[model samples]
Target: MAYLADTYIRFPIKVRNASGVRIWDLDGKEYIDTFMGIGVLLFGHNHPNVIRAMKEKMERYVHLSNFFLDEDAEYVARRLISETGKGGKVFFTNSGAESIECALKVIEKFRKRNRRKGKIVSFVKNFHGRTLGALRITGFERIRIPFIEHDTEVVFLPYNASEVEVFMKAETVDAVFLEVIHGSGGLNMIPGEVVEVIKFYQKKHNFLLVADEVQSGLGRTGKFYGYQHFDLDPDIVTIAKGIGGGLPLGACLMLGELADIFETGEHGSTFAPNPVALAAGRVILQMITAELLEHVTNIGKAFKEIFSQFGTVRGLGLMRGVELEKRVTKEEFLSEGLLVNIVGEKTIRFLLPLNVSNDELDEIAERFSRVLKV
Candidate 1:
């Protein structure tokens, strides 16, 4: 602990092991994990299928440069494109932030190629990522203040505000980065009115819409992509978190005309298409079937019924946030043998696995109810 950097507000418990939806600490105390590795473990920690795929790929070979052709990479990319139901190319990355950076680059290149200079529209309280390019558009002022010289011109509109209508009509926007369900900034779902405005303006203005599905995509929100919940169709989409099946894999999917925005030397990544991660990702994509999505929906409904007694519940499917009437702490939840994410002091964000069972949900509900009663 002394040697490690204090970057993360480290969890008190040192995890000994995890399986399904439960974690065991160093002292052998079992706890229900609602955070699900910040929504990265779609199938829970060390899912058998994900593990088998990775092991099988490792047996064959592991690291191969992007210059070489790999079947797994091609398959994963094709599957991702197919899931979007939109014809597009894919750029692989190592994490959500890298995927976001890739999306930004696509926006820049697209604007340049078309000889159009315009501002990028992003919503306030939207959590994109932490990198410089991502932070530039990210709505958090505290984090963005340190890196103020972002250089790119971006308009930060209030999330789900009617003010967006004015900006859309007045501004020549190159692209708009949106989150169908906001993750780190509290699980706020983007409303229908805003989605309609963006869709309407996109038709009239011809600007690109980039959906940031890092936290809410790949069955996390009971859909293949979060934007599917809305009527909007994004031209560019950045994905991460559960897409790796608990490993580090991300992608920036280009759709419509923006698919060919990048040429040969324009963009690349060294470890983006790692065989092991892609192998796991391929299984993840296969496992998020219609049945699993329905399970997620039912679980979300159960969660809402339990949590609504505490306070307002926001978000859809397994992606949920409970804004309690009383302020709570992560330490309090930890004390109750429950692991959950606390955003600020009042909101508890729950990113449970898509495969979590009804019994597991009841256990979580009981644990959470106990915590609130305290």
Candidate 2:
């Protein structure tokens, strides 16, 4: 019997320790961690460099209020902004939801400054964070139904290229927030043409384009940012999950023009730029160089080849999904001792760690094939 809140259904596995591409339960059973802590362990569990950075920063300080600027935070911010290539500034926060909140503030302030009462356009199956404002913009009905009261003036459109243009043209929207590769929405991939459509509409209407890269960034999708796949340059980008090397950290990156709208006291978090988290983030980002990205791409190709035997494979890089046929049920497959995530009733999503080995991939595929046959 476990002694914790019943908020989450306890899996049979009680994790004791985790390392690259694998986790061990207290019972001494090991499993390949394809889910990768819901896409947080981008560099895999307890990477040595990340661990060393965290420990070194812990000796200096852990949590300093946002009042004082920390050097670690500045270092991370500089690196992130440089990667964006848009001369954007960054605002640090502690979680994905907080980062969304920061993005919301930026959008609202931008609209207010322009004297426009425009709506925020989101998609039909998008998943932003769970805060009130973020939830309002989120696209999943099951998650949004309970909190419908908090959402207003938000327009939802189909995740298709034609529909996006039609929606933007018809509605006076201030911004359009999307996930370049939809993670919680069942590892859905946005069409490349749809991205071109978004860019075209943004140029025509001057609405802000926001990409939620919380799950798809930091080499998760073969690129530093998922938007890179679509050749997109979003006006604002929200990042978290993998940014802090398994710590609680998030960041909102915006172009200098859009960032200027948020004046002093506009937004802040108490533990936003925690030194320990930023230190780890720095190491993780450094490790995600050209060679590591190539590794991710190669692994993604292998995932495609293996998952194709099951059914259709969707998504890019380490963020991918294997959609089992209607004949396969997720409940029936749980007895196989592997921890795969089922979304949208049929898709078995693999948020595989960036460094997952080919041998581990082979094992996962064999186990999955065996379970699928059963």
- Most TM-score-accurate candidate: 1
Candidate 1 residue pairs that clash: none
Of candidate 1, the 10-residue stretch with the lowest lDDT total is 143-152
What lDDT does candidate 1 reach at residue 158? 85
lDDT of candidate 2 over 206-271, digit per residue (tens): 888898999998888888889988888788889999888888999999885885767788777777
Q: Tell me the tens digit of each residue's lDDT in model 1 across 166-225.
A: 888788999999988878888888888888888898989999899999998888888888
Compute the lDDT for candidate 1.
0.88
Off by over 4 Å in 1: 149-152
What TM-score does prediction 1 earn? 0.97
TM-score of every model?
Answer: 0.97, 0.95
**How well does candidate 1 match the true structure, expressed as C-alpha RMSD?**
1.3
